[model samples]
Target chain A: MTTRSPLRIEPTTPPDESPPMRPSDPLPALPPPKPDPATVPDPVISARSLCVWYGSSMALKNVDIDIPRHKITALIGPSGCGKSTLLRCFNRMNDLIPGARMEGTIKFEGIELADPSIDAVALRRRVGMVFQKPNPFPKSIYQNVAWGARINGYKGDMDELVEKSLRRAALWEEVRGKLHKSGLDLSGGQQQRLCIARTLAVEPEIILMDEPCSALDPIATAKVEDLMDELKEDYTIVIVTHNMQQARRTSDMTACLMLDEAAVQGGHRTGVIAEFSPTEKLFTNPSDPRTEAYITGRIG
Target chain B: MNLPVPSGSVERPRWPAPSRFRRYQGPVMLSLLAICALVTVLTTIGIVAVLGLETIHFFRESHVSLPAFVFGTEVDPPKFGIFPLIWGTVMVAAGASLIALPIGLLSALYLSEYAPRRVRAVLKPALELLAGIPTIVYGFLALVLVTPLLKACFEPLGLKVDSYNALSACVVVGVMIIPMVSSLSEDVLSAVPRSLREAAYGLGATKFEVSTRIVLPAGLSGVAASFILAISRAVGETMAVVLAAGRMPNVTANPLRSVETMTAYIVAITGGDASYGTPKYLSLFAVGMTLFVMTLGLNILSGLILRRFREVYN
Candidate 1:
């Protein structure tokens, strides 16, 4: 493993130019009636009373969360806590699961995400996803980066776009000379980054990563974490992870989900958000006893 | 750490020593299984030896030369030609492929990608049952029904349709192999990881694009292998071709004309009253050897296609 510094020193954007805020950033939305002061001034995705079920068993129950624009928000929890489910709900990826049902509203950029008339395909184009497993298509590296854009009717200099996407994912420096090699030939870390580049090629506004480094080694994990830090400058990111250290290292906001022990019904445990706050505050001064217990390893 | 220390007071569990019968069980079972495996290997060797010896004897006969047998155009008196038989087999195999490949592939795509769970459970086995129907029955059906149907459809358009023709044989043979192609291809397509589908769907690709562009291309090696295997099955198909396609070994491309495939020729000559040591009797082994080589080559080609192009999934 190449032990490069985890902290990236150079900025891809010009030094004179800061991260651009959208015109919609000025308004502090007031729909929830009782807004948490810790919540961001603007949110890219807001899920209200989101409940998800897989067939007869419930997975998530009345969980509310907000993912702010151009910020990295980490969802951390133990197994079956539904952190991954919540992240999937942002892009409606749960729709792919058979018998998966969801109730409640997921508003993506002021539009109802669950509306039947809202094309999921079009929604996915605006909000791309990176899976827990690196799933590079069985094609050349160039094709892996270019295919999504090609199918989505991208009309531009494809070679330039591939280069830009790869560069943005911090993978071009290693793969620039072998652009035509199979994407599967890359190492696990590179494959995951390649997946990130594939997601970026579509120019999505938000990127949902589901434990993007769980299958990677620690060194590779740090590389992906570094890539995530760089990516949050241009794209809103919501990542589901079990590694609490990773959440603190890479995210400004963190939401921890826990099994609702008191709400256990018919032998099934529902998942609810135990705490959602700034990463530093949640780790240091947790208000909820359950959150403190979980943070201190007394319970999960 | 205040861990419990062993006091050496508790008795350890003990297992009994193996009995005399138990000691011999391993070698006994090993030899039993080894013998069963050796049976199949010996059977294949036996077949090859028989075919080789007879083919060599046929070639050594006074009037029969290896080149003349393979490349000559006559089959009577002095000349022994196998080209016409090979041509007929090729024609049937190619024509059958034209029918089976697209239909089989589409059926596989539908089964793997579009069919509901309940529908697939019932449909998959039912589709495989098509392969269970005896080939003799297919031959009879082709001779009595398919030939008449084609004649009725095409004779009106002033096209000559032979009572026993390669067209009907091709149709029946093609239908016979649809299950083989569809079943094999569907297994391959289904083996494509769900993560890849999710990846495509995540990129806003429609289900159609996911199936055709991603899943199909990912399993291209297996799909190509299935096609070759099906074509080989069609090449070696005997009863249906013998009954539907007449025993006339003519080198022609016309589907409406009568033709005899290699398998059909072997069947015809073997059933006829030719003397045991005559060239005619020995010709059966020669034709049998050709058919064996053809199918062997195709099977090896299929295996090669699978190994050479298979996508490794981690």
Candidate 2:
């Protein structure tokens, strides 16, 4: 419950420069080493040694990180870099794909999510997701928002929940007047906001968004970014984005991934983490050369 | 000075002359359009003219009472009427569709939603084989095998079953038309955008829920059209009904009782020796026209429903 902002003022290195520690600029110390399990506070989700493979090809390699509670963390990377793959692993969405396999552990609220005994349906109820494209069922706006709650056996004041969720998504004012209208009738940006509202109605602890604003215009993207900032007060948010500026604007922490060489047998692309740090530090003074090059637009 | 400058201004480049081949394009295109229009009009006129003239001649020559023809007429000698045949046709078609709809839709659901890609590839072609088998073969199988099996099943229940009855014909027709329903239903179900299913899955819906709630509703129009087409085929079916549905024109509700269908009656009178101008012979065209009108009506109704309810996801 502590908001500790320990500014780790590290020396900024150029993209092509060597890793030299400067005496004047004190390198920011990493967070205190994680406490033992007996004393450790629970993280919303902790992915340890997470690796994913499709058939013979590896998509994610040895990624270990903890997503803190009630904060927005953004994963920024180039295309085919496995950020989406890692986000999908949180809810086992990869299971739908043929030949997809995973190794290592994903613990959600201290429970091993990849365990065979885990019920995926209940797991998804606690961790809802919003895709890049706005896909509302060819149904009324009310029905679209009510779907997740109804499916999860929600037995509350549905009308209140719907209004509150839409308000939380910053979409109620525009859409409340047309609750009975088709979801598809809304503009793309409004539709996406409606999707966020739908996801919120389920009362999930964590909300995973995969480039939620990539398809939107600048104004729409800014609106969603603002919405994310407000939502972080109550919900843990994990988002993947190709836009580096979006990562800087909306995230408390940033993790940058880059594609490694393909596997010989299957030609499967593997992704490796280049840098993971506080957003301000990562964007202003990156530790890794690849991250510096990527943020500055010198290389993809 | 301005006018003189315009007159001596640079002359535009002359356009190239057309090739000889380009000259015939207009006539050729017009001729093609005329041929298409002529073919369409001729087909429509030909069908209407044949059905209309034959129906008129049938009514003029036939001495059968019109009321009895429409709604079962009982005479001293049990004179011919179309009401019993119409009843048999409707009964068989409706019963067959009832049996076929669930099985066909389930199989289609499995193909579209459950089966793996490789398995679906193999299963789809295998199911299509049912459509390729001739209708006469189904008629033979219904007569030779289905009739006996029904007798054994019904006799124990104290039901008086005829060898050729509506039950056998309907069951055989259901089996024969399974591919039509399944194939069309599969296409429609597959046409549903994958995004919809993914949306449902993201909402924590089970596969069964996604299929039933989203896929089925999205494809309802196509499924309805398939049912109507299958039923029309069942109604107009001649060889199978003639062989499996008995020739006796009994207006009974019991499916196990012997009955005659309109198509079966037409086959009966036409197959036997009869003078062309006689009342008995004119009865065939009347029955044919009635069957044609009924099937056409069903097709039109199905088209209307499809236009009304078909989902446009784009």
Candidate 3:
């Protein structure tokens, strides 16, 4: 019922018109602090100066981020801001697309993931993903969960593993009665949980979620966010979300990316990280004016 | 003063006014319904009347016993019967379907899953072109080209050669029906949601695993329907069999031996000069009726199979 206009920020003034703002602005005039390379936590996966191009168009520009271990990090941005594209880079899922090219170092577990020595199949097994929409194979619920383990050549006790994974996903009690039924027969929330169970069955060290709750109702979204909180005790999670509330609720760290109009080429566009910080600081007291504007619902 | 004046006001009608067009809606709808019912009944009656008359005339003039018409009789001129022709038709159809099913299904898999967009676009139309070629042309090709090629290929392998045999006819018929099977199976394969494939890939499964475990099983009913339809086409084919299957009404099951299907036998008998109201003349109708029954049975079987295992995705 209420329409709010976006807050527009003035660009940097030309040198001829006015002198540049002094080092002392109203906001705390601190220099960009660089974390000491030795003190910084060793990232399980890190991308340095990452850029992606589609044909002649650039989609990402010099994105540098480090994913800490055993924690949930959220990528929050407006639509078409390349959060999903950056999330997909962890396991090289972007390789499936045509005419997509990337220039960067994606180090997974201190090893360069994009190097020729790193097998894409093995990397995907180690880092699993759950999509925005609940996509269950047209199979029995049991088969849906067992498929990952089977493909990964797990020759262990599959029955126990399936049960354990389903229970971890908080879906075993509800779905155990109907394990033989088609996975597609479940409710939307149950299907998404089943997909999480399927991903967990493979025992991946890290999981990437691309707007996992965007297709679900509020209740389902709450359940998934709760699951993500529970999952972070064991697995590193990287989630892309447009819901700032969800990022505030579930993530320990948040990275906000915005499209960089200054970097656009011809008709092409690119996204750059506008801010990255602890969730509490980013939501309650963002340092950047643009970040403050976004968090306050003044601009998106 | 106003309230007192209102007591004497006349009442208006309770019903709303109807427009002229609204008043015509009921009668127009009823007339359309009547016309549709009439057309359906007339078509059904026309088919039953024509087939019923011809069948009765055929049975009356054939001089063949009813039991002998269904099974075979060892009478002097060998009374017309459906047992041998039905066996031949089933054998040819089954053999042809066996050959076409795997090839068509695999090719469909390639086109729908593996081929790039441009290659698929070109390949699909080329396969459909195979279906559009006239059956008469296939028959000619089977007679003049395929049979000789088969003979040449088989002579060195220590197999006897018949110029017109079930082997050549079935092979050619299978080739003729390839496009139907591939196109129908391709449609069913493509109808599977892309999310299913993505889910499999996300699980670290290879492309082959995804295709075999997910796509094929999902499309099984449609693929089975396509196979059944291809078999029905093969059974009902007359021109190819007539040209290549050598009109011998033998009850053998060997594909290498020359055989006559029900349709080919009917074609052979009808194409010959036999006086009207004679046993031989009536035999054509008997064979024609047998062919029709076989095809109808196949169609019903295919429909039942499709209904039984139809997959529902929501």
Candidate 4:
């Protein structure tokens, strides 16, 4: 809980210039895409008519979302609204849950993620995720950052990669002195940042965070929020949140999911997208009445 | 305001009183539980006392040399050495563990990490059934079936093995404890939280890497404990070793040679000879004491390994 603001004030670029990390930071690094008002930005990931089912009952139906590159996109709604489900879809992380199934197309870099020819392992190298709770591996903080990179055949200087990732997560100042210490020994906020650093060492193009600050105190939450804002300069982010203000404060665009009231097919209520717009428009002048009620705290 | 403040001084807080039965029944039940717990401790001490007293009597009353009795290989008349039996016990247990550890742990890994629900439901209980078979049945099988098979395999290769050989005992003992190791290891592996697996997979690790690096390491303490327990079981096994491994006091490391284990010596001596106060009768207690010490050491080692590597999950 020590003051964690100085790292944010500093620039995120590597201090001492070294040869670029090629294995992870894809060849010829694409500059972070600017969200220009005059032209439409290309979607880093585009899901078309996505439907998901857990066993027999449908969880989500015909949900479409275009997540812009190098910008924070927030998914917000009440519980059981399938916002987290949609976030996990970006990395095909839903495949891990038993009996959970998905249909329709989720395309990343113009390739369908669900295609059998595409390798999930290689796909995950470019699309990483941070979980709802801080889950740093039960290893030293140094190892926690180095493990993914090592397994992915990172041959460059691991020490430099570990330092740069920690700095990017805004966790370097507190933990650089104790890199060999267990990641589990950190406070809740630090642990979450360590998890983020673990994801960053792999050098993914997009990062998905599922309520990364829900377990943190207000001060720690602010620290992570600041880090997220800084992260958008390099990585495309998709975040799921119950906190509407967090969506407004951190994201460039926001998507709201709502449960279907009418009987879909089975007797169960299904979740679908109610609105998708720029964060400002979604908060202040939503086209959907439901989004306005949710923003104003009239209904959830 | 609709709410009214408390008037004057605050009264002493009222508390919910316990029912008469709730208040009075605790001591009675707790005493009953304490008695049950004390029974186990008392039983262990009673066994040790019986063995120790007889062992001390044997050492003192007999006109035998202590070093010769311990280190000698002869079993005729005055010198009754126990070293050969201890060596036999260690060799057989070690040989059996060599066979059991990898096969059992791999089966456990399959059940916990790779197998589907249908496969696990059928496989897990079938393994436990292997453990529940009577050891006497295993002894009968070893004597009748396994020894002949070993002789058939090795005799043509020019190794001589008796009808009752240590190889039969070690192999059968290994098979018997496969279920013991597999079942215990499966339980421990299953206790490893799924969140660790998810984290590894999210990092792009395959199922193999997740099971081996993440889940296996996290569950090390429990796996090590199961291994120690299995070794202890192998050390104390009696009936099968008696029927399969012959009653020869050969202390050699050759597994194909006929040998006698500590449990076998204890059982065979007491079955048909000498008065209660005789040196031969008292020898059984000395051997039993040695077996108890060996198992106790293993149990302590198991605890140490468990405390050192146990990964705490929040």
Per TM-score, the best of the predicted structures is: 1
- Location of the lowest summed lDDT over 10 successive residues in candidate 3 chain B: B73-82
Docking tier of model 3: it is: acceptable
Cα miss at A130, model 1 (Å)?
1.3
- TM-score per prediction, in order, is 0.89, 0.85, 0.84, 0.88
Question: Would you list the rank order by TM-score, best first?
Answer: 1, 4, 2, 3
Residues A1-300 of candidate 4: C-alpha lDDT, one tens digit per residue: 111111232254331222312122222322233232213269999886677777766677666678999999999988888988888778878887777767777899988975646778877889999988898878789989998898888999999999999999999999999998888999999999999999999999999999988999999999999999999999999999999989999999998887754323335656777778899988988867777778899878
lDDT of 3 by residue, A1-300 (tens): 000101322355321232222122222122233442322287788887677766656677667788878888999877787998898888877766776667767788876865645676777888999999999887789988998899889999999999999999999999888998989999999999999999999999999999999999999999999999999999999999989999999998888887664543234456777777777878987756667777788877
Q: Return the top candidate by lDDT.
A: 1
Interface quality of candidate 1 as DockQ = 0.55
Off by over 4 Å in 2: A1-42, A262-266, B1-45, B63-68, B74-80, B277-280, B303-311
lDDT of 3 by residue, B1-314 (tens): 45554543457554568988899999999999999999999997786666667777877876677788878823124466677777778877887787888889999999988888899999999999999988888888988998899889988899887877888888888898888899999999999988787777777777788787788888888888788788889988888877877777777867778887788767766777566767777666666666667777877887887676655555
lDDT of each: 0.85, 0.80, 0.79, 0.82
Backbone clashes under 3 angstroms, per model: 0, 0, 0, 0
Please give the DockQ score of every candidate, comma-separated.
Answer: 0.55, 0.43, 0.43, 0.43
Instruction: Give per-residue CA lDDT, model 1, range A88-141, as digits (tens).
Output: 887788888887767778899888975656788988989999999899998888
Where is the poorest 10-residue window by lDDT in model 4 chain B? B7-16
> Which sections of candidate 1 miss by over 4 Å?
A1-35, B1-14, B17-37, B300-310
Ranking by lDDT: 1, 4, 2, 3
lDDT measured at residue A20 in model 2 versus the true structure, 0 to 100: 21
